[model samples]
Target: MTDQLPPQPTTPPPPAEPPAEPLVAPTAELAKRQLTPLAAGVLGLAIGAAVVGGAWLVTATTGPSEPATFTLKGTFALTDSVYTDPGDDSCRGSADSGYDDIAEGTSVTVYGAEGDVIATGSLGQSNSDETGTACTYKIAVPDVPSGEKFYKVEVSHRGTVQLTAEEAENGELAASLG
Candidate 1:
């Protein structure tokens, strides 16, 4: 038998080394490079100004709004024997009756405070009194602008009848051409 080699003391291999750190900076170190307070405030103000300016531009470019409007209603009466209704929807004035200009389907105009024609309509069917001595025509001018200090109504070029806003709106205007 070969002589056995002298026994030598055995030792475990060195423990494996831990992994190396990455090249990038840690999270806490990167947070320190964030924007300063003043820079952040300036950015916020710029955003706010842009928003306000955009709104202002939109409002300025828009066209003016339309005015409010209402229907003006009243009556136009011809209280003269010369105006006669022949059992028809219309009434006719005799020639040389002085009120010959006034008739059924005549133009009725509403004027604004500045003398602008705001609305125009025509006289409706005529209604005769039992005595046949008078004829009344309904006046309706639609889409008359409101907020005027006063209104003027004209019937078939007959002189205008002045009315306050309240009077015009309340249908208190009654014009007669005899």
Candidate 2:
């Protein structure tokens, strides 16, 4: 059994590799192999077309946002003094922009700070034909209060321009009395 012990085996080594040569010669030779002008032009056109076609496909599959739909809502108030005649006393009232466009022959009423119908006017179709960002109405507040009084203006619209008071009690309203 001792004599049967196997001798250690050794495998032959792999073959040695050849030394590497610089790639400069092969690269230069490849560069020297040039295509004809016509072939080069055709190849350039094909590359350009491929790029353009790819871009077109990408664009065609995608869509742009819909044109924005927006609107503006607002209201304003104004107070003006009016005298029956040059020598008559002036009365106080207000004009506001927030009524259903009253049609000709339509009856309209405006309330004062106390909710009293301060003005009772009729809508005239004569000026109803106009429309745009601004509108004007020939309002006739047929009767004016008989004594010295205060006036208030109120305006309202959508969320854009909600109701607001126009008077500056600290004498802002009187500043325009003259």
Candidate 3:
């Protein structure tokens, strides 16, 4: 008999690797989180109301504060026959006579309903009508307060002309001295 070969040693297989971790957590580990549709709508409405109420409060507190003011504009007409300049396009008045108040730089005053002076201005240069029989001076009194029931405007020492606040707002005031 042939000599028996030496018994070969057998090698065991390598051990298997452990499984990898999952990307998402298992359902048992996560808690449920959600809002009902009615609750969501009520929250949105509350936020909207807060914003609107805040805006209204700010507007009411800060103003409608400053009283309104306006310019009082009109004309002062002089019809004295003695002051007419027939040869020239302009009219002339004397400081010594009745027409003195119609001269340039005369003070124009605006009074409120309480008879207090509200504004003051001066007459501009004199302009003559086509016939030179009438002289008109422009009156521009600025910063006259509004909201008065009425106004009284005076040029120099001449009488005051009463005007409703609505009429004065039209800016068509006029005063005359002959």
Candidate 4:
């Protein structure tokens, strides 16, 4: 038998490509479009200055924190709770039967970092009905130094009392005096 060769396979030609152009425009056009050396230097300086100045401004606002203050929570005894009659000089309207009870005035002395007395304040008054426990007062001491943790609190009415260390750690001093 006569052997016949296999038929030849057909192949397609490659596609044509578009003409290539220069990556950049003409030098004259590029020169017109681009910044000069002096211009570039000034622009770079301005940008750098703007970045630095912006950083400085941001840090200035958030830096150098103000000093810390403290609030003391404690109870004060009410030696007298009788409200003086504003309209007429008389003592009859007493909430507790015939006696009124309110917290008396209190003062505190706070020492500074140098062991000198830095701040002193008188606590506000609290009304009482001559019953229950003593009245509670929130003693505020402002403008304490940043480095000072404890202020050596001395209450006028309660003598000496120990406040919670946690409260002192969080810039607050709290105590209860009967």
Q: How much lDDT does each candidate structure score?
A: 0.84, 0.38, 0.82, 0.55
Model 3: residue 106 alpha-carbon error in angstroms:
0.6
Model with the higher lDDT, candidate 1 or 3: 1
Q: lDDT per residue, candidate 4, 72-170, as tens digits?
A: 444343333345444533222246633332233456766654557666776554434344223445566655444564456666634444334345446
TM-score of 4: 0.39
CA displacement after TM-score superposition, residue 128 of candidate 1 (Å): 0.7
lDDT of 3: 0.82
TM-score preference between candidates 1 and 4, better one: 1
In the range 118-156, model 2's lDDT, one tens digit per residue, is 544453222211122222233343443322134432222
Listed in order, each prediction's TM-score against the native is 0.62, 0.24, 0.59, 0.39
**Model 3, span 12-113: residue lDDT tens:** 778789788899977866656456899989998999999999999999998678778998888888887536545655565656676655677888888999
* Candidate 4 regions with alpha-carbon error over 4 angstroms: 1-45, 54-62, 66-69, 78-107, 112-114, 118-120, 129-138, 142-149, 155-164, 167-178
User: Which candidate ranks first by TM-score, i.e. highest?
Assistant: 1
Per residue, candidate 1 scores C-alpha lDDT tens digits across 28-130 of 9998888889999999999999999999999888958878888898888888755565656456565677777777788898898999998898887787777
Which residue ranges in model 2 land beyond 4 Å of their true spot? 1-35, 60-67, 73-75, 80-160, 163-178
Runs in model 1 deviating more than 4 A are: 1-65
Cα displacement (Å) at residue 131, model 4 = 7.3
TM-score of candidate 2 against the unseen true structure: 0.24
Candidate 2 vs candidate 4: the TM-score winner is 4
